[model samples]
Target: MIHTDVTEPQDFLVALGGNMPSEAGAPGDTLQAALAALAEAGADIRAVSAFYATPCFPAGAGPDYVNAAARIGAAMTPEAFLALLHRIEARFGRERVRRWGQRTLDLDLVACGDAVLPDADTFAAWRDLDPAAQMERAPETLVLPHPRLQDRAFVLVPLNDVAPEWRHPVLGRTVSEMLDALPAKSRAEVLRLP
Candidate 1:
């Protein structure tokens, strides 16, 4: 939970994704409202990415997603920030139904510290993985360099929009560099909000 060494002013990235709302107004409005809620919860919003409309993951369940990223400076631990994220999502009517499924909001803690995590399973799963591996193959760890970071243009393009200079802890690639390496189809569906 205490992921960063820096205190108070550590720069952390928060990513949000949701499909266009059935209600009036732009899809990005959902993200903006969420960001404002985060701010109201006491995190400092440093910067934000433009909205990126990209095809849904796992293919075909709903329309494309409106995704965006943000940089925040907070005094709380990663766990506290995650709690705040959930609160904001609830305020905006996020429902937990399916994985990568449609929703009113989805706040992902993509990265926390400068050091990439080798364990990201829910706290309980991470602990069990180390102890239970001998009994059976534990679920794969949720290491961050996210494994999918470079491959998913939805993650990369919006990430680049906000944190182009963010360097991969292991790969040393900037967001832009990783983005450039992705296949054309990778980001082929990502369109910047006008």
Candidate 2:
């Protein structure tokens, strides 16, 4: 039997973080507004983690950031979903002017089910990127499971709330496992807001 509909609706993981304020007023507000935008843009949001207050990347690039994670079921291709996210970010005045720069909004496509975007080898290349190279380089294409998710307490801590059981398609580690693996000081940094 030819399986014409082999693909299931995938729940995509999204990681939202921002340090700068937009017209929305504050970093947390921007994250809330972005979630609403995602819902309006055809994403069937299944879950959202509580807002988190985390220090900015690179120590002092800007103010501390608000972070959160969401799981949404979307039927579109990953690229299209990413475009939608970028459009929403642009709507909030996000600019691609700098890598990991302070932004009004940042929506990252963290993962989608068990799919290894681009490919495993490429993903591995990014996953194993050196710290200096990571600071200086950004991938030209989408990388599935977000190459750095495993090591980021800011991302994994929020993700633990929404998808603690979700396993890495390549690494086979669950969100909670990854979160637990981080240093105590690192995990302690992601403080959830009321």
Candidate 3:
């Protein structure tokens, strides 16, 4: 049940990532479950990117990841939305055992409304980094213009596939623009999710 007295409808960005399920769960399963969970939490998904499998950063000892990005309209603050995401992750059996380790679910509130995160706390650190740093150290903050929105082809490509017209409030760039800005090497591994 969602409490809706505190906010109005606004767009949100959610990114998903996780390695092959071991004792956790399947990537696809987690992604879909997250979608349903988000909907249940009061956000209506407006667009969803096709799943993209990519190697985890920092070269971890994990399997290839299945990732996606979603655009949603909800009546919740960024903080509330993030809290709900963690709850959904916990329901899917995710545990903080390893940094960038495999998991059954990983729903990240990559952006919220039109507000840029301005803090550097555990819940808001990435709010101040550039695009590359945000991608390199995600799960740190759900800041927007998604500090790394313009650099990670993994995110840009999927986001373009889903919402080409989506624009960054702070940078004044569209999803296509962001994708166009990624380095060639960063854009290499992404493909159209079927």
Candidate 4:
């Protein structure tokens, strides 16, 4: 029988990270398995960045993290895509024990084309939150382009690998530009995993 895929595909930027071991083994191995699971769940795997070894946020909270980025083409709403990401994380033994706490897997929906998941004002407020205020809380829902995407080296460095030119719909800066804008030390902290 002749069949054609009818789902409307949209570009998606997903950030993957973890510091703890899982059923798949090491953090890096777990991430690889997560990618395969994403593909199996119907994300059209377009490109993936090399993994990077990054110091944990908050400096000395836990073990170092293995981080990476993936560019996907998928036919799903941003909310649906985010839900799928959560499901994948759950499959990999992810647990939300604490904010910024280490885990077995983290699949973050960094961006979904130029579409904003909630609205412009909420997105802007979260994106522009003061560092001190940010530590006090987390968004209750998915935030597109990730609220802190511009400030995180671990996310930006690997993102530059597969989608250096992808612009932040709200910030209007390319991934490469965002990576360059980070403080020298922050940028230096992300070492490519060999």
Candidate 5:
């Protein structure tokens, strides 16, 4: 059910990451293959940031991850687009066994145009959620602009390459601002892969 003809073709920001290797090859190779899959499956990928090598989130979830970001455009709704991302993850052997666990691939729908998904209050609830709570609970529904997008250096450092000027609909901060907001050490940990 890919949206071929539609009235709303929204801009999309996607965060890509993986620590575990898939059948495609190494984590970086898998990410490259996944981007190709997105294009073949109908995403109008506009730009992709450089790959980064980041320490495993949670300190010891697994090995380090290869992370990147992509700005794309598609005619599908956010929900439909998320489903497509999940399907692509599945193809890469992604498993949802636990939150923040190591994975073969992760294709997160970071934002959809300026849309505040579900609603402002609901988005705020997750957006303002604490890190401890974030590890213990996962939202049952999608939140636009991704609640934790502004907080993760690994996410923003790579995202800077593709969309530094893209502003957060709720936070009123650009990607560059968020990246700068992160502690210097946090940003330093996300080293660009040559």
Candidate 6:
């Protein structure tokens, strides 16, 4: 297991996503409340991307999703921070019924200050896993700089808004660069939420 030395108040990138309604209201409103919850939970929110409307990943799994990204400073270990995110999801009534299923809120820890949890080799293997394999299983451990980030326009596009220069620890590509590398259609699918 590999671990990076973490400094106090490390920066973290969190991906926000949801398609279902909750006590907090619509998906976009739920995301806004989630951000506020993060701040209440001791996350010093540095930046947040504008909300984007993205089609459901499975092409009909559920309603369109509201997606965004936020940069935050936190004084907690990666694992602990992830736990906090999960707790917030639970608060918003998220369920783990199916992979990539609809949800009221989904907060994914995208990156933590260039910190590579577990190890680089494991991260690479997961990052390169075939799409079919991805559908069959999820990573057992957290993968920093999120393994599939570069391939998802929903993530990269919103990340570009807040952290255009944030470099992927392993890929070494900036968010804007990754966003530009995506096919035009993938980019076009992420429309700003009105």
Q: Which candidate has the top score in TM-score?
A: 5
Q: For each candidate, what is the lDDT?
A: 0.71, 0.89, 0.72, 0.89, 0.91, 0.90
Leading candidate by lDDT: 5
Give the poorly placed runs of model 1, Cα more than 4 Å off: 1-7, 20-26, 118-147
* Candidate 3 lDDT tens digits, 51-156: 8877775466777778899988877777777777888888878897765567777776667755777542532445455655544554543555555566677678
TM-score of each: 0.78, 0.94, 0.80, 0.94, 0.96, 0.95
> What does candidate 5's lDDT look like per residue over 92-144, in tens digits?
99999999999999999999888898899999999888989998898888889
Overall local distance difference test of candidate 4:
0.89
Q: What does candidate 6's lDDT look like per residue over 23-139, in tens digits?
A: 999999999999999888767899999999999997999999999999988888888888889989999999999989999999999998888877999999998999988888998
- lDDT per residue, candidate 2, 100-176, as tens digits? 88999999999988889899999999999999899789999988979999999999999999999999989889999
Per-residue error at 92 for model 2, in Å?
0.4
**Prediction 1 global C-alpha lDDT:** 0.71
Which RMSD values do the candidates have, in order?
Answer: 6.0, 3.8, 3.8, 2.8, 1.3, 3.4
Question: Residue 169, candidate 3: how far off, in angstroms?
Answer: 2.8
Screening candidate 1 with a backbone cut-off below 3 angstroms (N, C-alpha, C), the clashing residue pairs are: none
Model 1 over residues 43-101: C-alpha lDDT tens digits? 78888888888887767878788988888888765666666778777777787666566
Q: Least accurate stretch of 10 residues (summed lDDT) in model 1?
A: 131-140
**Candidate 5 collision pairs:** none
